[model samples]
Target chain A: MYSKELLKGTIEIIILKLLVENGSMYGYEITQQVKNLTKGKIVISEGALYPTLHKLEAIGVLSTEIIHIGRRQRKYYHVSEVGKDISALKMQELSSFLHSLNQILDFKLSS
Target chain B: MYSKELLKGTIEIIILKLLVENGSMYGYEITQQVKNLTKGKIVISEGALYPTLHKLEAIGVLSTEIIHIGRRQRKYYHVSEVGKDISALKMQELSSFLHSLNQILDFKLSS
Candidate 1:
């Protein structure tokens, strides 16, 4: 698992980016995708993941549909139109922040 | 204000980075620092910031000291030893993510 301290901040980004890439997926699927992508290095716990999904949906960044598969009702999440634009902007802002950080870390590398 | 979708993911990083830069600060000070740094473009509501802080401290990534200043007791947060190392790693991971995103975004720009 990744560091809790670090992962706390970026879990939403990971969820959003995953939805952007995958179209739509259920909660378990989302958690599984993160785990598979990270090779089990990052596990998004159900406790943490569910609340985040609920929060994102509450904010209108994500819209969900409930589907009944057998006995289980699964809620699938997808990005809203606004969520897509917000994702792009967030990617840009994160890029800028990373650039600044690289400058700090790579100061000696370039010289 | 920054996009809610985007800021949601990076708020923890922002808080951690601020603590790393400034040593230690109280909740209000941390909120003010974020607001000032973003030119009031990113406001961390007490509703949000307090929980994030409490969660971080709960996980042992942060340690808090309660200090009485005049009329109120303020809890100040600082990075733990583990938090500092985790911060460094998260910075690296985020940097790597930004690099990949730039490559995708800039591919069209470069062409």
Candidate 2:
């Protein structure tokens, strides 16, 4: 697993992007999806996951629905229109950052 | 400027790698090198730079030399043996992360 510090800046963006792309997901599902997608290299603990979800919800970037199944409540999250916009900007920013990083690390950064 | 959050995980490794590759650099030089390499998209302020250098020095991943030019004292930093090993691991981890992220965001992660 990568350090929490390394993962901190990205969790929110990853969650936002996944929700925007996948339509809707519960917290546990998001964690599972991230794990599965990253092939277990990146694990999202519940401790780090819910707070980000809540923050996104608080900021009007996400909307949630609670479903009751067998006396257990599972909250499902979806990105709002605002979230879609934010996700696009975030994806662009991440891409740009990573591209700059790639040049610095793997290619010639000096023109 | 990219958010500090996005840059937090990267600065230390970037500094270490640059110092390893370029021999040694002072704090201000590291900041300016990052700016020039990223084409001003990513800026590392002195406030963010020194503490990280100090932390690396404290951890023995870096060694510092004080060079006196006129009345001014400049501290130049170089990566130690341990830092080179650490830099390799960090670079690999970061590459793995960005690869997984690329798959998730730009390709199919459902395979």
Candidate 3:
């Protein structure tokens, strides 16, 4: 497991990307997919995940739908039209930041 | 420029690596070196740089030397033995974290 510091500021983007990939996902599903995608290397805690989802919603980058799963309603999240553009920008920033980091770390570039 | 969130928690290691690479470097020199290395893509400001340097020094991950250049004296920073071990762990954590991030972002992995 990596330090919490390492995961800071990044969970939101990952959450956004997963929703885009899976079409739409509920809270638990988002957390589960993140774990599966990274092979359990990155786990999103409940404390961390909800706030990110809510923040994205507040910023209008995400929209949600309430689905009835038996008796309980699950909140499913999906990217808004704004989110696609935002995701593109955020992903670019993240990608560029990683490239800058790689240069400092002297790691060979992949993309 | 990338978001400050992206650069958070990684600056110390960069400073550590820079000192390690150069044997030792004064604060101002360190900032200049980073600017040069990242081609100004990553600029370490004095506010951000000094605190990180001081924290590492306090943690025994860094040690300092005072040297004279003309009439002025400058404090040069270098990694301590403890720093090497810490540096190794931090670098490994950062590297692994980046890899995990790449997997999520679906970016091509380099290292």
All-Cα superposition RMSD per candidate? 7.9, 3.9, 1.6
Give the C-alpha miss distance for residue B69 in model 3, angstroms.
1.6
Off by over 4 Å in 2: A107-111, B107-111
How well is each residue in B24-104 modelled by candidate 2, as lDDT tens digits?
Answer: 999888888988988998887888789999999999999999999999999999988988898888888876776766656
lDDT for residue A32 in candidate 3, whole number 0-100? 84
Give chain A TM for each model in order: 0.87, 0.91, 0.93
> Per lDDT, what order, best first?
3, 2, 1
Candidate 3: count of backbone clashes, pairs at least 3 residues apart or interchain: 0
DockQ top scorer: 3
- Model 2 chain B: worst 10 consecutive residues (lDDT sum): B102-111
> Which of candidates 1 and 3 is the stronger one according to TM-score?
3
TM-score (0 to 1) of chain B, per candidate? 0.88, 0.91, 0.93
The better candidate by lDDT, 1 or 3, is 3
Model 1 chain A worst lDDT window (10 residues): A102-111
lDDT of 1 by residue, A39-86 (tens): 566777888888989998998999999999899898989999999998
